[model samples]
Target chain A: MIAEIASVSFIGGLLSLDVSAWGQIMVSRPIVCGPLIGLLLGDLKTGLIIGVLLELIWINVISVGAAIPPDATIVAVTCTTLIILTESKLSLGSDFHGSYRMVVLALTMPLAEFFKTIDVKQRKLNARFVHYLDREILKGNLKAVGKVNNFSLFLVFLRGFLFSLVAISVGVYILPKLFSYLPYAMLVGLNFAYRLMPALGLAIAFNTFRGL
Target chain B: MQNLGFLYILVPVLDKLYPEKEKRIQSYRRHLEFFNSHPYFANVLVGIVARLEEEMAKEGEVKSEEISAVKMSMGGAFGGIGDSLFWGAWRPFTALVACVLVIIFLGKWEGAWLGPVIFLFLYNFLHFHTRFKGVLEGYEKKTKVVRLLKKMYYLRTIWSSHVVGLTLVLLTGLVVLFRDWEAIERLYFLAFFLSIILLNRWRISAARLLYLLIGISCVGGYIF
Candidate 1:
């Protein structure tokens, strides 16, 4: 299970890198990556559910220009993986529809902000590489240009892989323990939030189209 | 990395334009400056650059400054347009449909995988097509891409309403899934929907409203 989790995390990281690290391909979007991880876990349904939720919620949060938005790929991938894995370990039964998944999602929300900071740091590091490439361009060193470009992509891949690896590693132990103690009332709220979050996400999406 | 991505797209063109090492280096430097644009419309910028570079290579009438000026000016304006068009309109349109499917198949394993697959197909179809065509069109027609995009304004309007309609369907699905909704709770749901629409109409930040709704749900948990 550990080996499987690590490999899946690595792939998820690579896809997440697709958002901007290389091509602005739509593969890294939550609608895709979430179910991708779920498919890897042998449960495409979990991935689809979480993917739709995160994709809708973060529909407006795009990386426009220099501004870095919260990394939804990481959130969707991690949350889906954690929930599915945790459910498997505990045998969370076949009747899993509401609170359990919602709790996992609620817990994973903070990681989006946490990973955003990491994303910003990665970009800042890429800035240094860009500066180095600038000098390489001056020297007409095409070899160095390719090297730097490849290295930057590698760095992004590494950032995502390591982040997910660490998140899932830590979460594997912590989430189950934490879930036992989370109040019933809080879970109820999460279930409500689960319902409300879609509308809220849609509202945000609608806000973007206001001028049109 | 999107800043660097522009260089990648231009590398082949740069190599083709400047045969001499010194000329190539100079051309490379011209494009290596800080660049960030809406990813989809970047094709337009790339297309324009490709054309300008071609002109520079053939006629030498197009100065590097003119090229740089176009890059600087067009990037921001087109970035705005692309953001609103692709990110704002196209994405939400696809996502709303995808979300509706997820809601429809909330617990059905057989049907669950369909939503994300459809989403990727629809979105990438639009996303990649625009990217490829934007570049080709920009390269072929140059500044006329703006007018071309202007002609598509009605499409944007139509897509916007699709988003609104899909959103209402999603909200309706949520309300249906609640199992037992009292009259007052139904009214609150209606108010919640209206308030968000109104807040958006007034141009209040949706982020603030999102946080407020989350907070209300969190604090109001005890009441309901």
Candidate 2:
């Protein structure tokens, strides 16, 4: 489990980098990163299902100028990792659209909101790094500029790694037990809602595109 | 990330243009002022700024204030256009297409890995290709990138329309698959769809809308 968390969190860091650390590559997107993590966890279906769902709903969320959208990449990596890991431990069957998955999905949405606040704080800290660079430049320390920029990227990477590590670690312990207590009928409803979620996802996608 | 990301572009360009130490320092300082825009769209401005800086260094034809003016003016426009087209349209369109492909080929868990591979390949191909191309066009052609952006607007429209069609088809597939759904369930689905559209139109946050959906679905679960 430690090995899995470490490796997956590293990948999370890389994808999180796509949000701002480097190229605006779409790799950080849920559709891409979620499946990739799922593949690593030996459950491609879990990853793809979660990825596609998150991609559909959060399709319009973006970092336009100063506004930071929820860190969908972290949400993707953390949720997919937790879902697959928990399922393997519980010896659950390969029903990717089951109620357990829906419960996990429900729990994951708010997690993105939490991580987004962390991201805002990290950017604020990065602003201080920028100021430090400005002072270094004033002192004719051109070489320091590269170090400062690289350090900022490192900070973001570290933040991603730690967040993923903690989120997945906690999620694996909480999600299964939480769902295990639900009534059979409620589980059935969750499964139904899980199936119906794609419609809402598609509607969100349509709302986004219609505005275009 | 936005400010630092652009520094990578500006530093090298400024380095090549300004050989004098003092001049290079001035160039760096000038650019270090707060600048933010959509990252992908910022490439065009980076290209344009590189060109303007080159003009300033080589012929002194452009004033510093004019370059700053160009950056300020183009920043908001690019942000709006880039957000609308790339974030609003292109991403959702490709994602919907990917989702449809996944449903078609791997819905039953057969060869599921292929879905993510296709999605990553298709999205990155469009994303990085246009990103680099935007920079090149902005650098080589400067203001003429507007024409290219106009072309992009048409492409975005075409792609978005296709996504809408694909989504409707997928929704139809759902209705067909669940033919045995209770009448109340069907009505609930209709209400869910309508509420999503109406709430989205009213500009509710996606997260909040999702929370509402989940809450309502959970309560409906007990009643049904």
The model with the greatest DockQ is 2
Residue pairs clashing, model 1: none
Please write out the lDDT profile of model 2 over residues A22-140, one tens digit for every residue.
77668888888888998899988778888888887888786666787787889889889988888765544556346777787778878788888988898889888888888888888
TM-scores of the candidates in the order shown? 0.85, 0.89
Tens digits of lDDT, candidate 1, B1-224: 45577877788998988889999888877788877778888888899899989999999999998888888888888888777667767776777677777766677456766777788788778778888888999999887778888786445674556547555565654654364356666666656766776776565533355557656766767676
Q: Candidate 1 chain B: worst 10 consecutive residues by lDDT? A: B201-210
Which residues of candidate 1, in runs, are more than 4 Å off?
Answer: A91-97, A183-212, B1-3, B153-159, B162-171, B174-224
**What fraction of the reference interface contacts is present in each model, in order?**
0.45, 0.50
Candidate achieving the largest TM-score: 2
DockQ of 1: 0.44
Clashing residue pairs in candidate 2 (N, C-alpha, C atoms within 3 angstroms)? none
User: Which regions of candidate 2 are displaced past 4 Å?
Assistant: A91-97, B108-112, B151-188
Q: Give me the displacement of residue A49 in model 2, in angstroms.
A: 1.1
Residue B177 error, candidate 2, Å: 4.2
At residue B69, give the lDDT of candidate 1: 83
* C-alpha RMSD of each candidate structure in angstroms: 3.6, 2.9
